[model samples]
Target: MKARIVAETLVKGITVNAIAARHGLRPTRISDWRRKAREGKLVLPADKNAVFAPVKLAVPAIAAPTPPVPVTTIDLLKGDVTIRLAGDTPAARIAEIVAAL
Candidate 1:
């Protein structure tokens, strides 16, 4: 429950005071959870918003230019099944797939 609250505050950008007031908790308690979350002590919910993807930069080669290839893919896993989609897939399409799942 505390982890959820902290995740809501961090991922959804909700103010600690607001969550505390809504849940009848002291703001300080929520702040403590936030600190723990920052310190990797609290386990928050798995959320795409909470995820940080690494970025890589490539230098151009002196050889003839080649067509740029798409290298990223979006993977959705549920149970024992996994679905992979192009990184450039439309948001609406992804939403439909998620809803269907």
Candidate 2:
């Protein structure tokens, strides 16, 4: 292929005449390919020296969720007096406390 022949010329020790001789092609043909590449018409492969490896991504571990803590304080104020009780105290008990105050 023209691309392969052109790529050969790009190698450090390889020459257009040598590549043309090896492929039984005219050196002028390879020159034309190079010209086309310079003019943005032909595409060339990556350089042999430029190597790459595939990348792998790892999955992260998930942690167990913690339980929520319950908030447990209620306050009642009458004049200058303050009363504190558990948030779960019954409404009837609160009414009795309020009436006693």
Candidate 3:
């Protein structure tokens, strides 16, 4: 019962030191009582109509990951030589063609 009173006083915005002083106990004892109440070891009277303000969590919205686009390359255009190729074209073959050109 004493622990409950100290916990209630602490909940009412009173400092733990002040509550302990008022009850002729140490501040550590009041803190222990508060911890017990928080951990469900000590049950306080439920005030059915006690109103609390709404709380909003600042969580960001998750976005979908974008897929990688296909890549195609090679736009070799010279005086009279035109060579268009895909991205996977072999470097040796391209070098050979360019050497021939």
Give me the runs in candidate 2 sitting further than 4 Å from their true place. 51-101
lDDT of each: 0.88, 0.89, 0.76
TM-score, per-candidate, Cα-based:
0.49, 0.47, 0.43
- Per-prediction backbone clash count: 0, 0, 0
Ranking by lDDT: 2, 1, 3
For model 2, name the residue pairs that clash.
none
Model 2 scores what on Cα lDDT? 0.89
TM-score-better candidate, 1 vs 2: 1
Residue range 1-101, candidate 1, lDDT tens digits: 98998877874567889989999999999999999989999988887655587999899768987877875899988899899999889989999999999
Q: Model 3 compared with the native: what TM-score? A: 0.43
**Best of the two (1, 3) by lDDT:** 1
